[model samples]
Target: MNVRGVIAGLLFLPITILLSIAVCLARPFSRLAWPSKVMQLWANSVFWMSGIKLQVVGEEHLTAGKPAIYMANHASMIDIPILVAVLPGHVRFLFKHTLMYVPFLGQAMMLLGMIPINRTNRTKSVESLRKAGERIRSGIDVIIFPEGTRTKTGEMLPFKNGGFLMAIQEGFDIVPVTIHNSREVCGRNSIVTRKGVCRVTIHPRYETTGFTVADRRQIMSDVERIIGSAVQLRGRDNAAPVIELGHH
Candidate 1:
């Protein structure tokens, strides 16, 4: 284990625990306002302790008070904190159901109103997706990593289609977000963080207002293409984006 990473982890553990407890306790009164700020502070502490730098683009695509599904490619664990810090408003995660039972974190997530996607079986998964739809309809934006889990090889994984199914069914818009070089900071199956820059590009929103289930695969494929084009899986570069859009 790297001494620097271990030290960073030790420093952040107590802060994390305290912040989680604070969220669980304060959420009932403040709803999401205070808890959201605490989440940002917790995320900022992680980046500061690990010496992680972030460069973001296309934030203008997100509009205030508009509920949408923010879909992104999952490359590393750092992607979670990055979204929590960078994205505006009260954005909740679409995490796996098992995470909802993880001690303090579980209680905090429950109080903070983060929806859990139960992927145990088809019947249960559909029910969970319906629950997510209710959250979106309530005027809260949800950030979903289309690739259900972090990529083990830094390569983009095939999306699980649950987010898309929810989007089309509920007539919510979809925003494609691309994150590059996140793996260099904290890769899968590792808690160690390396000093590196993570580039994020939030693409224009993809509308799903009148989409049918038949159009799900096409929409999914398009989002996958948009996010995958920005990063190189094999040749990792943690400085700047190699593929730049018109303005970025």
Candidate 2:
């Protein structure tokens, strides 16, 4: 690790803790806004510390004052901050249930209405999705990593069905965001940081209002293509060609 990187991480610790506290305290009244704000702050701090800048495109594609299911490919851990900082609307993220057990921050995330999934159990995963659907129906935008986990080799992974299922069930529009250059900045499974510019391209939102279970597979396929095309258009040399969900 670079000396500067270690120093930056140390500086980030207190800010992260303070924001965590704010989220925990603000939970009682309404969780619809505070979590988003806290996430935005966290993103800003990370961007500043890592010397990473962002360029957001297609802002017009997002609808204001309406809930959406924001889906994106997982490239790096920094992708979270990039999305939170650049995406147009407020978002609540779907995270692993294990995260809710992390000291003070875990408690804060639980209090602030973040959806927690028990990836080990199918029954619990379904229950988590149902609860997420309810939250979207009630007008809170949700961010889900359809790939379910980060790409190990910078290639898109097989997308899980949970996000699209919830979108169809709740009649929410799906905003497909393509993040570029994040993998190079932090890469997958590595902590060595570098300074670089990241870009988030927001494609036209696809509405799920009239979709049904029969259309689920097709919907996921189309989104995969959209994100793949966006990545290629942005000149990512190794961008993966969109593939059928179960093929790879």
Candidate 3:
């Protein structure tokens, strides 16, 4: 077992509890602002504890005080904190409903008013995205993992249509974010995490102003390609990456 990974994993539970409490306390001060600010701290803490370095490109594309749909290719649980750490504005996630049972994490999600998508049910999932779209129009940035679940391999998964449909319905610009090397740091079903750098490439926003439902497939294909552009083609690994990657 990787010693750093084992130790880091052990600390996660306490770290989560402390951060979750902070989120709950911050909620009373300013609904979204305080909570979001605390989450940024939480994300950074996760990075620190895991010894994971972050490199962000196209951060200029993330406008402050703007509401848009941020679509990203998901690979690992680390991707959650990665999005929270890098993306600007008050951002919330379109997450699985099952996360609602993850102890302190679940309560914090509820406090943040994060949208939970019921993946087992098609209509309910659409309804969840609809609710997320409403949140966007009301001036909140939402991050959606179009892949729906973490990929076991380093390859991109087929993009799901729910988030794209919501983007068209809401008429928000889609920021296609590409996350690199997270799977190596923390793979699916793994409890330990290794030290590594996870580079995030935030491409220029894809506007959905004139796009209709019919255009979603093309849009999904395009966004998926953009995100996959920077991903390294290789078999998946569960430990920290050994080879050097990403420019500083």
Best by lDDT: 3
In model 1, the clashing pairs are: none
lDDT of 1 at 184: 79
lDDT (0 to 1) per candidate: 0.78, 0.76, 0.79
List the candidate numbers ranked by lDDT, top first: 3, 1, 2
Looking at model 1, residue 33 earns an lDDT score of: 83
lDDT by residue (tens digit), candidate 2, 1-248: 45544555565546667887888777676566777777777777777666666766777887887888899888887777777777755677798788677766576566557789877899999999988878777777788988888888888988888888878877888989998888888867544467766777888989887789889999999999998776645544324332111121
The C-alpha RMSD in Å for every predicted model, in order, reads 4.5, 7.0, 4.6
Instruction: Please tell me which predicted candidate would have the highest TM-score against the true structure.
Output: 3
TM-scores of all predicted structures: 0.87, 0.85, 0.88
Evaluated at residue 200, the lDDT of candidate 2 is 74
Give me the runs in candidate 2 sitting further than 4 Å from their true place: 1-4, 101-108, 190-192, 233-248
Candidate numbers sorted by TM-score from highest down: 3, 1, 2
- Runs off by more than 4 Å, candidate 1: 1-4, 101-104, 233-248
lDDT of 3 by residue, 161-229 (tens): 898888887788999998888888898766578887777888898998999999999999989888888
